[model samples]
Target: MTDQRQDAIPDAIPGAVPHTRGVRFAVYSAHAKAIDLCLFDGENETRLPLNRTATDLFALHVAGLKPGARYGFRAQGVYDPDRGLWFDPSKLLVDPYARELDRPFRHDARLSTFGVDTASLVPKAIVTEDRPVAPAAPRLPKGGLIYEVAVRPFTLLHPKVPAALRGTVAALAHPAVIAHLKRIGVDAVELLPITAWIDERHLPPLGLSNGWGYNPVAMMALDPRLVPGGMAELAATVATLHENGIGVILDLVFNHSGESDRHGATLSMRGLDNLTYYRHVPGAPGLLVNDTGTGNTLACDHPVVRRLILDTLRHFVRQAGIDGFRFDLGTILGRSPQGFSRESETLRAILSDPLLADRVMIAEPWDIGPGGYQLGQFPPPFLEWNDRARDDIRLYWRGDGWKTGRLAHALAGSSEIFSAHGLGETRSVNFLAAHDGFTLMDLVSYSHKHNEANGEDNRDGHNDNHSWNNGVEGETRDPAIRDSRRRDVQALLGTLFATRGTLMLTAGDEGGRSQQGNNNAYAQDNALTWLDWTTLDDDLVTHTARLARLRRRFDVFSESAFFTGQDGDVLWLNEQGKPMTTADWEQPDRQQLTMLLKTRDREEDRATRLAVVFNRSHDALAVHLPGGPWQDLFTKDHVFSPVLPPRTVIWLRELADPSARDKEAGES
Candidate 1:
C-alpha cells in the first residue's frame, strides 16, 4: 500500500475520489455526530472513522482500496423520527454520487430506521473507473419528435433483440430498435427512468413490479437490473443513438425516491440525514412535504440536494453522453418555501450551468402538491408537457360540445396559455397519450380504464381519461367498428403531426400497441404492459410514418411563431370556405372546420397552400374549397368537389405550380 501521509484537503467535494494511492471516500452530513466508512469483502468488513472537517464533510483516504470495492456509509445521529432527524448507523447508506450499485434493492423491515442490523439487506456502492465519453450532439429545441418509452417493455417482446439483451439498456442500441425508432421519425428517445429503484411496499404482495420506473431510489446509479453491464452499457446505447442522429433524453425523477412516506424504508438519503435531504412539513417535524404524491418530496431548495441534482445531471452528460433530460414532476425543481418560482435556485442553476446549458430540458410541469400545476410557468429554454392540449384534443375527438374552440387553440400551440409567459409554440411538448395515461390505441378503443391487474381493484389508474369507445367499448369483431376506430386513430395522429408544437409519441402508439386499457401500468410489469411486437399493426404504423414524414417535410407544422391573423401565413375557414369570425369559434355545436396553411417562403409567385379539413360530425360533408386546383396528398384524388367522410381529417395541397410536387418530394 502507498503511504497515506498526504496533507488533508479541507472542504473537498463528497463521494469517493480516485487518487494514485487508491480512493478518498467523503460524504456530507450537516447534523451527523459521527460517520464511518465500511468496506465489504465477502462476509468480512472493515470500518474506518472518517476525519470530520469544519464544513461537516467526512473524509478518509484508504491506500489499498481499488475499483470494484464494495463500500457504504454508516452515519450515527439522533434517530428521532418525530423530530425529522433519522440517522440510523446500523443501516448502510448509499453514496448520493455512486456511479454504480452492486444489486437491486430488496425492501425489508431490516432496511427501515427501526432495524438494528441491516447491512446485508442493502445494496453496496461499487467504485468504478472513470471512462472518457463522447461529446453529446445538439438536440432539437422542440425535440423535433420525442418518443417516450420504457426501456424494458419496449424490447422484451422484440423478436430481433437477443435474449440476453432483452429488458436491458443494451436492447435500446440494438439494430432492430434503432431501425424502428427511425421508421417512426423519432428524433429523441425520452426513456422512462432507468435509475435504481425499489418497488412500493404494496406491489410485492400483489406479485407486480413497477413497469414505468418512476420510483427512483438513486438518481446517479443506473439500475443493475436494467443495465447489467453498468454505465458502459448505457454509454454504448447513447453513442449508438447519437450515431443515428437521435438524442437520448432520460426521464428523471428527482422529486421523490423509492423510499415512500415517513413509514417508508431508511434508504441512502434518509439514513444519512433525513432532516436535510427531504422537505418536512413546516411545524410538524416527522411529517414530510408530500408534493410528489410519493410520500416525501425532495428538498430541491436545499443547497446539498441542489448540488446532488446538478452533479447527477453532469455525470450523465459527461460519462454517459446523455443529450438531455425530461424532469418528472418538474414543478418540484422550481418550488420554494413560498411556492413555485421561475427563479428558484435549482431551476436557475440548471439553466445557467455550463454543462447543461445547451442540452434539451423538458418538464412534466405538474405534481399533486399545492401550486404544482405550473404548465406555462417554467422559464425559457424549458419545454413543458402540455396537458391542456392533450385534454382538449381528446375532448374534441370524443365529440364533446364546446370543444371545437378549445381544440383550435391547442392545435395552434395553446398560444393563449403559453404566449403571455414568453414561451413559443415549440416550448409546448404536445402529445395525445403518454406513459402515465392511456396508450394511443386505448385512447380510441376503451371508454374506461381497466387496471384490475394492478391489484388495486381497478382503483389505481386515472378515472377521467376523456377517452371515447366509438360505438362500442373495448375490442370488437365488427368490421365497421374496427374501421371507425382505425380512422379515428389516423385522424388523431395526423392532427398531432400537423399541430404547431413539439410532438411527443408514446413508444408503441405508432404500431397500435395497447395496454388493455390500463392507463396506470406503473406496477404491472408483465405482458400486459409489454409491447406485442409480433402483433404490431402495420397499417397503423404506415399511417403514423406518413404523418411523421409530413411533419418533417412541412415547415408549417413545426414553426416557432404563433399564428397571427395579419401574417397571411394561416387562414381559419369554416366548412363553407368563408373566413371564420368570432361567431364561428363560439358555435359550440359546429365541428367541421378547415385551416388553410400557406407554405412559408416558397419559391413560387403564389405560395403553395395546404388546406387541412377536420370533419368531426356524424355525416359526410361537402367541404367547399378556396377556389384553387387541389390534390389530396393521401389518396392523390383531385379535389373538384371535396366531400370529407365523417370523423375524417384530409389534407389538400394546391396544384397551382407543377414544380410544387418536386419540392415536396425533395423536402421529404
Candidate 2:
C-alpha cells in the first residue's frame, strides 16, 4: 500500500489554509491518540475528525470553509499530568500555528481542571490569508541608537494622538510620535511584545495586568487588544515608520509562554503536546524545567519547536515587514539537555536562513537556569544587552570608590568583556536603564526601591540600585536638589552618547520620565508609566538633542572597533595633565579624568581630536589638557578654560586648521 502521509495532502503546510474549494487544517501531536476539529458559528459548534496523515500529524479538509472561520482542536488520550500527558477532549485547544486570535485569551479557573468543558473560555483561532510584503533591508546603522518603547504606555498620554488611536499600534505612526523619535536621533524602535498574552494568575486579584507583554501565548498572533486591525495595522505602521526612516524591532519571548507552572492554564501548546513543546525534568517527566523565571521553558532544541520558531520569525518578516527581533531571555534559544551552547542548531539555522540572514538579531543573553548567564557568548552578528555597562555607569556616578577604571572600560565599549571571544569589534548594546528597572530620572531621584505599589510588599525590584538622592528622596521642591538631579541626568546622557558601540535609550529617559522609584513597574499600566510630555524638562531635552547631534557629527563616537591606545586613537589623562600612571589609576578617591580621541569632524571634513572630561568632585577642579585651539562643543566658547564644573561632563574639540576656525566663526 502507498504511504498515507504522502497521499493525504501534497506538500501540505500546518495550520488552517484557505484554498479554492475550502480550507485545510493540520496540527501536530506526538502522543495524542486522536484529535478533532471544532468549528464555531454563533453559539453553534461542529466537530470533524482529522485523519492521522503522518507520524505526529493530524489533518483534515472542510469544504466551503473560508477565511474568518473560527476553529479549535480537541485531543483525546490519557489524562495523566504526572507523566506529561495532558490531553483532554473536553478542553478546546488552540492551534499552535494560529496567526490571528478571535479575541484575547482570558484567565479562567476551569481551564486547568480535567473533563471540564471549556469551549467558551478559550479563544478560537481565526483563519487568515497572508498578505506578503516586499523584502527590505533593516535601516538601523551599525552604531545607531535604539529607543525601547512600550507601545501602549508610550502613546497613551501623547496629546497629539487621537483618543481613539491612543494605546494602539497605529498611534506609533502619528506625526507627534515620529517627530519625537526623530528629535532623539532614534534609528529604530524596539517595541515591547505586541503578541497575545494572558495575564499572570496572580495579577487579576490585585487589579493589575502585565503591561510589558513579556508573557506571550501565541507566537505568531498579534494581540487583538493592542492591534485590533491585526496584521494590517502592524504592516501599515511599519510602512509609515519606514517612510520617515525608522526601523522596527519586536521584543519576542521565546524562552517561556504565558503558561506558568504545573497549575498554570493549558491554553494551547500545553494542551496539544505538553511533552514535545515544553522542557521537562530528565528523570521526573512530570516536573517541568523552569529555565525562565516565569514558568516552564520552551524545548528549543527539538526539531518541531525549531521549525515553529523559524516559521514565526519568517511570518513577521515576510508578512508584516518587521526589520528585526530582540529575544527576551535569549540563552534559552541555545539551550538543550546538556546546557546552553553557542553552536546550537536553532541559532545556526536563523543565521543561515535566506530571508533572515541580514536581519538584526539581539539577545538578552541570560536567564535563571543553571549556568544561564551567557554574556558575550552569542555568535557573531548578534548584539547582546550589556548589563555590565549599566551597573558600572551607575556605580561611577554614585561616587563609588575605585570605579574610574571601570567607567573608562564601559565608555570604550567594554572591550575587556567582548574581546575575550576573539571578536574584532564590540557587540554590546549599552544603556543605563531599561524597561525591567528604574528609569534614568529615578536612578538619581530614589536611592532605594519603593516597590510598595507592585502589590509585592516592597519585594519585587532590585535592592542595590547603586543610586543616590541628591539630598531628598523621591520628589522635592528644593531648587538645589532639583538642579543637582537634572545635572546628574545630563551627565549620564553625555556619558552614554560618548560610549563606543550601539546605544539604547528607554522611551522617556532623555526628558526625565520616572516611575517614582518603582524599579519594576511591569504591572503599572496607569499614568505612573505613561510619558508626561507636558512636564518634561526643556533644558534636559535640549541637552539630549545636542548630545545626539555631537554623536552624529563626530566619527569616533559611532566607531565599533576597539581602541588600541595607539596612533592617538585613545588616551587617559589625569588632573595633572599627564598620562594616567599606575598610581593615579589605583587611587580609590580618583574623581577626575580625561579621555582624548583622534577623530574626524564629519561636517568640517578634517582630522581633529576630541577630549571628554569627567569631574565627579564636589568642588570645581582645574584640569589641564595637552592641546591648544580647543573649543567647548556645548558652550561654543573658543577660549579654553582650565576650571571644570563639579559633577559635569564636557566635550572639547581641537580645531584642526584656520579654515575650520573660519567656518565655525561664520556659523556662530
Candidate 3:
C-alpha cells in the first residue's frame, strides 16, 4: 500500500482544467455509415471528421479542448428497431465516459426515447454540460460500517432535505442526510449506482419508474442528473463524507449497461465497438447476448474491454476518492473467452493493481451466465456478499429445522466456502437484506412478495424470501405478535454484529425499513421506498444503533482482514454446550443457537470476548450462558449465571473493567 501521504493524492478535481493536453472521447454508433464530431463553442459549433478504425471507433484530434469542454458525436444511418439499426446523425451523442453531463434529460418536449427510430422522442445521446468537481477526500476502511442504499429515494423525500437536492448525488452532502448517517454510526455509505442510467422503454409504459440505478450508461463519470451541481457537486460531496469520517463504497454495475439487446438503445460501447463490447448475438448477425437478464452483457473477455473496465475503476479511485466498490453481477468480470476462470486477466489485474489494492473491493458474486455463481471465488483483500450467510442466518432465526450446522458455518464466516482462499472470517460481507430484494422489515412482515405496487402484478421480485412473520402475513395489532417480530429483528441484528466477519448492512434494514411487502421496490420512487426518517420507530432505531456500537466493541467484527487464529475464533454450541446433534440440525421448530467469538488477533490492546445467545421462537425460552462474567452488550446487565429470554437475543462481552459500566457509557 502506498504511504498515506502526498503519493496518495487523488487526480486533479474535474472542474479545474487538467494541465495535460488534448480532449479524449469514446463514441458509439452501431449502424452509422458515417460519423461526424461537433464541439460547442458557446452558440457557434465546430465540426470535424473523426478518424475511423476497422472496429468503427471514430477519433478526432483537436486542440485547446480539455476536461469540462462540451462536445458531442453525430452519426448518419438508417434508424430502425425491427431491422436492428439505429443511427441518427442529427441527434447529438454523449460520450459514455463523460466526466459530467451537460444537463439532466427531461421527459417533456425534447427527449430521446428512440429505440431504433430515425425520428424519435428520446435521443440516443445527451448534450454538452459541465458541473464543478471538488477536491478528493481520503478513503478510510477501519471499522467502517457499509450502508448500501439506492441513490434516488434515500434522500429524495427526506422531510428535512431541500427539494432541489433530493434524488441527486449532491444531496448526499446535504447536512440533513449526512447528519443522519453520522448519527446512525455508519462508517461508509454504499450507494447503489450514481452513473448515468436509462429507464427501460418498456418500464415507463407500466406507470412505474425504475428506482434502482442498475442499468448504467457511463462507467467512469457521475450522472449529471444525480448532481444538480454535476461532477463538481459530486466531488464536493466526497470531501464532505470524508470530513465527517464516512467512506463511500459505490455499487458498480460492470456486468451490463443500459443498452439492451441489439434492437435496444445505442449510446455507449455497443455503438463504439459492438462485437468487442457486448457478447455477440448467438447464431444471429446483429443480435446481442442477454446474459445480464436486462438486455446485453458486456464482453469482459475482450482485451480492450478489459482495459476499459480497469481504467474506469482506476480513474474513479484516483479522481473520485471512492473508498471502495461492490461490483453488481460481479461473477461476469472473471469470465474469459473460453469460460469462467478465476485466473481471468480481469480478476488478476484488479487484484495485483498497485493503485487499487488498498481500496475496498466487494462483489455481488453472481450473474445470469452459465456457471456464473462464484460466491467464494474472489481474491484476497476482497469481500463478497455471502448469499449463504444471508439464507442460513434467516433460516436459523426463523425457526427452520436441521439448520444448526448451516447456521454455525454462516456465523463462523462460512470457512468451508472461503477457506480455500486462505480467508478468515472477515471476508464475508454478511447481510440479510440488500437493494435487490426484501428489506429486513418485510423479511418478517411477508412470506411472499407483494410487488403489485411495482405494476408488475407481483411478478417482478424474488419469491423464496425465507421470511417468517411470527404467524401473521402482514401488520398486526396484537402486541404479542408485534413484540415477537421485533424480537426476531433484534436477534438478527445481534447475530450479525456478533459474527466474525466484516458486515455490509442494507440502508433502512436496521430501522425496520420495509417496502410494504414489495421485496422489489426498485421502481417505486415515492414513500414506498423513501425512508420515513420522520417516523422511524424508536425501538428499531435504538436496536440498529446498538448493533453498530456492539460491532465496534469486537475486533473481529470490524477488521477488514481475515481471522488468523489457530483454533476457530468462533465456536457453536447447543443449550447443553455440546456439539450439535443430527436431530438439532433438522428440526424446523428449533431455531435457537449459541456462539463464542474471540474479538482480536491477540495483538491488540483491550482484548475482548463475546458470547451470543439467540432464540427465534415466539414462546419464551431459556438459553445457557458460558460460565464467565458477562456484561450484556446492549443493556450492560452483568450475567455470571445462565441467561435466557423469550424469542430474544442476549450479547455478552468481556470488558477489562466490567464494574465501571457507567463510566464506559459516559465516554461513549
Candidate 4:
C-alpha cells in the first residue's frame, strides 16, 4: 500500500469525480479522526491515507484511477453508540456519490458495525466521469398523465420486449414498451426507484427480494441488476422517450437508506459518519428518529447531506437527461429539528435551484412522523400525491353513505387543499391507487390485505382499505360476480378520468392486475409482483384506453384554474334534474348525481360541453338531458334521455353544430 498524495488537491465534496488526468475521491466526515482510501486489486488490498481539509473533508487524487475502478472507504473515529458517534475502520464503506456498483448486495453480519475485517462483504464503488449534457426532454405539461411502473415487473413477461433487455432500464426504450405507453396516451413515465438498493435482511430467509427498489444505499449509482449499461443506457432511454414526446420522471427515495434502525447494517452513509449523516433522537443520541418508518431518517438539515442530495439531483438531470423526479416519503426533505417546515433550507434550495427549480418536482407529502401529513402544504411548483382523493373516491364508489361532498372536492383538483397555496386543481396528482396501496383491481376485489407471503403473518399491511369485494373475496368463478367486479372497476376508473386534475395510473391497472389481495408486495420479487402480460383483460384495457383518450381530448381535464360556478364551467344536479340543495347533498340514501363541465377558454367549441351521470344504487337512474343533441361518448350514438344501469356511469357530450357532429363522428 502506497501512502502518497498527488500534487492537485481534490474537491471538498463527497463522491469520486473524474478530472483531466485522473480521479479525485472526496468524502465528508466531520467527526472522523482518520479516513483511508482502499483500492482493491483482486483479493489483495492497498490502503492510502486521504488528505484532510480545513472543512473536515477527506480527499485524495490518484492519477491512474479511471472509470470502473472498484474502491471503498474506511472511516476511523471514536465508537460511542450512545453519543451517536459510530465509525469503524475495519468495516468497508461505500461512496455516497458512487455512480455505479460492482455487484448486488449480499447480506452478511460482517457488513455491520459489530463485525471486523469486512472488506469482502461490502459492495465496492466504481469510478466514473459523467459528461455534462442538455436535458433530453422538456418538463411535463400541466394535467399530464403520469404512469407509475416498475421496470422489472412491467417488461419481464412481455413477448415483444427482447429477453436481453427484459428487466433493465434499457427495456423501457424497446419499441414494444414505447408503443404501449404511447397507446395509453401517457405523458410521463415515472420509473420506480432504479438506484442501487439492498434487499431487506429478512427477505432472503423467506426466499424473497425487494422487487420494489425503495431501500436504496447509493442515490447516484444505478443498480447494475436494473441498468446493466449504467448511465449510458439510462441516457439513451431518456432520449428515445423524448423523441417520442414522452417525458421520464424518476421515483427517488432520499428520506432513508437501506440501513435499518439501531440494529441495521453499516452501509455507505452509516459508516461514513453516522452522527452527522443521520438524525439522532433529540435526547437519546444513540437512537435515530423514525420519521420515515424506514428505521433511519436522513439528516437533510445538515449541510453535507444537503450538498450530496443536490449534487445527485443535478447529476441525474444534467448527465442522464431525466425530465423530473417524484420523491418517495418526500416529507423528510422538508423536515427539520423542530418539525416539517415549508420554508426549510433544504426545500428552499431545491425550489430555488437554477438547474432544478423549473423541472418537474413532486412530493409524496407524508411520512410516519408526527405531523407528517402535509399534502397541500408544499410550496409552489410541487405536485403532491392526493391520498384524500384516493380514499374519498374509493368510499363513494364503495357505496359508503355521505361521501358526495368529499368526492366532489377531490374531483375538483382538491381545491380545499391547494387553493390556500395559491395553486389550482392541477397541483394534486390524482389516482385511485399508487405503488404503496392496493392496486385498482384489488381495490374492488379484496376488502382485506393478504400479506402472509410477506412473512409478517398478514399483519404488515393497512387494514382500513375502504374496498368492497362486490360479492366474494379473492378469486371467484361466478360470472355474475365477475361482471359486477368489472363494472365497479370501470366506474372507479371512469370517475378518475372524468375528474379535473392530473392523473396517475399504476402499471397493469388498465388490464386489471392484482396481487392476489396483497397490498404491500414490496418484498415479493416473483409472480406476485411481476406484471403478467399473458392473461390481460382485453375489455378492461380497451375501457382504460378510451378513458385516456377522453382525458387527453377534453380541455376541462387540463384546465389550470378551478371552476368558478358563475362562468358555467361546472354544475351539480340531483336525480330529479334540479340543482342540488344542502338538504339533498346531506341525504345518506341519495346515490345518483350529474356533473356538467364546460371547456375552459373555448366557448366557441360547442362540442366540448360534457355531462357525466353517476349511479351507485341498485336501480337504474333516469337522467334528464339538457336542451341539446347529446351523443354517448363511448358509443357515439345520439340520445335524448338516457337510463343508466345500476352501479354504472354515462358520459355524454353535446353536438351543437353540424361541423361539431362531423368532428365528433370522425374522432369516434
By lDDT rank, best first, the candidates go 2, 1, 4, 3
- Name the candidate that leads on TM-score: 2
Clashes of 2: 0
Q: What digit string (tens of lDDT, one per residue) describes model 4 on residues 495-591?
A: 8887777789998998899899999999988898888888878799888888888777777877767778875688888887687899887887689
lDDT of 3 by residue, 222-329 (tens): 666675565456567787888888888888888888767654555645544456577765555366667679888888877666767777777677666777788898
Tens digit of per-residue lDDT, candidate 2, span 206-291: 99988989888999999988898999999999999999999999999899998788898888888889999999999887999999
**C-alpha lDDT values of all predictions:** 0.84, 0.89, 0.68, 0.84
Best lDDT among the predictions, by candidate number: 2
| TM-score winner, 1 or 3 | 1
How many Å off is the CA of 477 in candidate 2?
1.3
* Clash tally for model 1: 0
Better of 2 and 4 by TM-score: 2
TM-score of 4: 0.95
What is the alpha-carbon RMSD of candidate 1 to the true structure? Answer: 4.0
Candidate 1 residue pairs in backbone clash: none
- For model 1, residues 224-248, the per-residue Cα lDDT tens digits are 9899999899999888888898889
Name the regions of candidate 4 deviating beyond 4 angstroms.
1-11, 136-139, 422-426, 600-607, 657-668
Candidate 2 error regions (>4 Å): 1-6, 658-668
Error of 4 at 60 (Å): 0.9
> Model 4, residue 571: displacement in angstroms?
0.7
Model 1 spans > 4 angstroms off:
1-7, 141-143, 422-426, 600-607, 638-641, 658-668
